[model samples]
Target chain A: MNIFAPVGRAFFTLLAQIGRLTMFLVEVVSSCFRPPIYWYHIGQQMMRIGYFSLPVVGLTAFFTGGALALQIYLGGNRYGAEAIVPQIVVLGITRELGPVIAGLMVAGRVAAAIAAEIGTMRVTEQIDALTTLATNPIKYLVVPRLIAAVVTMPILVAIGDSIGVMGGYIVSTQSLGFSSGIYLKNTLDFMKNEDVISGLYKAAAFGFIIALMGCYNGFNSKGGAQGVGAATTNAVVTASILILAANYFLTSILFAK
Target chain B: MTTPKIELRGVKKRFGPKVVLDGIDLVINPGESLVVIGGSGTGKSVTIKCVLGILRPDEGKIFVDGEEVTHINGRARDKVLRKFGMLFQGAALFDSLTVWENVAFGLIQGRGMGRRQARDIAVEKLAKVGLGSEVINLSPSELSGGMQKRVGLARAIAADPDIIFFDEPTTGLDPIMADIINDLIVDTVKDVGATTLSITHDMASARKIADRIAMLYKGKIIWHGPVSEIDNSGNPYVDQFIHGRAEGPIKMEVRG
Candidate 1:
């Protein structure tokens, strides 16, 4: 037996998967431009992916912000720079933690749900039923989810950013004994509009990744219950990883100057 | 001669090392019901899927109304598909939609009809399937298997399609319910005057609804004839299959 045979097979399998995903992505994008946009489905998905996700994303960002404040205070006290806590906290929350945390959290919540739903449809032959009815599955399923996620993530991230800053403010003013006005002033003065905007940009990319991964995994799922379970798990894991990976690249590009 | 409603010639499909359909050839005349009977994993479903363009054949040609459809795509494929309707083995109703919505789905989504108009027609179709107006608003999951099959039948015939495909129309129901469904299928198909191609291993269903019966074994049609001729086709395979005998030329692949 050739030792390289298994390695070559795995490589080819990976390549084939990449090719399939690329094709799926192209189909989804093109379908977005076609007629019968299904605005009702898009609105429903927005409510599910965005509106319902508000509390989770907000809570996550708030806690993250509070923790960052505490950490900054501890680390800054050693350098006698504890007064810089508010400045750094706002910057961190708006520029990095807010979008990334919300993205990852939403990926875990929404991507898994989308995958399981679509994967079940696939296994049950409902997707085939949709096809037989002359409804393009991508247009009916993927495009709505994609549009909802892209349109909603930035808004979700923006809200998350505000909640996160408020969290930092609460922690600093109440626990750290900083004046509320001073804390707010530092937060506002230190944070550039560009920082918040860049985070929203990352959020948009992350949203696309989350919906794309979910739809792709779900659409391709086979077997039965086990397959749907795998699709759900794969959607979350892949979306989370892609969000973080994209965050780094997006950050570098946006903040390069 | 009138053109066959749907025709498959030299159709072949395989997954990896396993060949599922080995050059299948068949024809269904308009308004005739052709049942392709086969055991599980015998490519009966694949054959139907190939004709529906859900699964493309590895090799061969498919014609619908004498128009070549094997390689059609996009709007053209949709146009071809609009001529057909299907009832999946498990009913395959959308849990998200109510029974009436499920029936009207092809009308509203595919044909772009107004929702109220589609719903009205959906209700009318449900009534034809012997479902009351009450069940129209209920979700599919709330219905029993037999009811779901009725709803599926309603959906299949809702659009008044030119050709309908039934994939194991009676697989998961009681014998009485199965017979009921079979009768309903015959009545509905007659009402619409639609050609049909059904795949099932159920002899009872095949006998009741099929004008012609085709037996698929080991990836090919072994025998096909009028339902009246199925019992005496003189093919041992068909005899053994219809009789449900374990000992025959067709051996079961049982392993301990």
Candidate 2:
């Protein structure tokens, strides 16, 4: 009977995990304001999490945009609504695909890196060393990373949104035999600032979520390399799920009608 | 005659069915160097972690300087932690930071000291550990195991803390390097007059550095006494561990 209770326990565990995430956010915010700001460490964190993450985010968006263009143009000819292809590609790439796909890729890359790096530090006592020096690890390690993700993810997303939209345009005009002038006009006419803004907001939130999940799992990691591996895997999976869920919530709020 | 700097009472920790740190009780006098000796995975590290609040024990209490530290928080916890300096099992210096930066990590980040002042102190601390200023700009990865330990030692004494912890400080170093580290430990502790607790599997390192020694077995301190009495501690577990014998009352937990 006890062995069969995993299903029930899992549900409660999920509830508990969400609670922990909320607690983590609050704890981090509270600690952020306290003394002992580690600016240099923050810069180092920005380098690791933000600057190093551009390549993966860029590639994911470009490919996704290119694929979207091909799919939309192919489907449009069935109803002779070929003019709608450009508009659809722009709207889809900017609003949904860009942020979501970029997020998933960065989440996989950044979250796992943060987790493994911090998890190793946790076991090796670097985190403890900070404490003994009277330096707060939450400030030195977690806060800088959280701040970096919050700031960088939006930038990555903005670039991703443009690149993704361009990817679709390239495929439509060059590969799929569409007139460049007409395709560009349709894309411009249908796109709005609100759509891009919403995507950036989502990207920022997703970045925070990625760093948060990674640092939380990493800081709490135990048992050495095996613990680091588990944290990395968990960060990717959890960040992906959370991004999707947050996307739904953001969309509903942004377009209530 | 000095007060006990670290005191643990009935400290017990367990992970699911696995019991670790079963009712560990000990007291370390101020300015004394104490070594905890045991085979690998015998809860020596767990005992130290319990004292540091890294892992909370399922039962028991820990106190530092007559103040209960196991459950304190906020500025109080921060204040308590300021008294400690630890050299991790590995040096654990930040790969992201230079050697001087790693050594000055606490002074600059924790205490909010100015960069120039912290750097000066970091340089001085490095010199104390026999590392020249030339080594300061290099990252920790550039250093060998022995040099890294020296950097770790520099970081530990950088803040001149009241207590210092060394976790397997000499495990990976060669015998000569191990002796050098022990000598550094002795000299540094003498210079700072800080209480020290270390966990090690190496008897020669323990013998060279410890003023007192304790042997951990089956999750408790099986024997504790002045360093001079370790050979005659009259505990077979201590005997087997220090002597490095294959057969004893202790059995390995091998799956084979």
Cand. 2: chain B TM-score: 0.97
Question: What lDDT tens digits, residue by residue, belong to model 2 across residues A112-202?
Answer: 8889988988887788777667667888789988888888888888888888888888888888888999888888888999988888888
Residue lDDT tens for model 1, B121-226: 9999999999999999899999999999999999999999999999999998999999999999999999999999999989999999999999999899999999
Report the Cα RMSD per candidate.
1.2, 2.7
Against the true structure, candidate 2 has what lDDT? Answer: 0.87
Off by over 4 Å in 2: A1-26, A33-52, A175-182
Give the per-residue lDDT of model 2 (tens digit) for B87-195.
9888888887899999988887767789899999999999999999899999999999999999999999988999999999899888899999999999999999999
TM-score of chain A of 2: 0.93
lDDT of 1 at A238: 92
- lDDT, candidate 1, equals 0.94
True contact recovery of candidate 1: 0.90
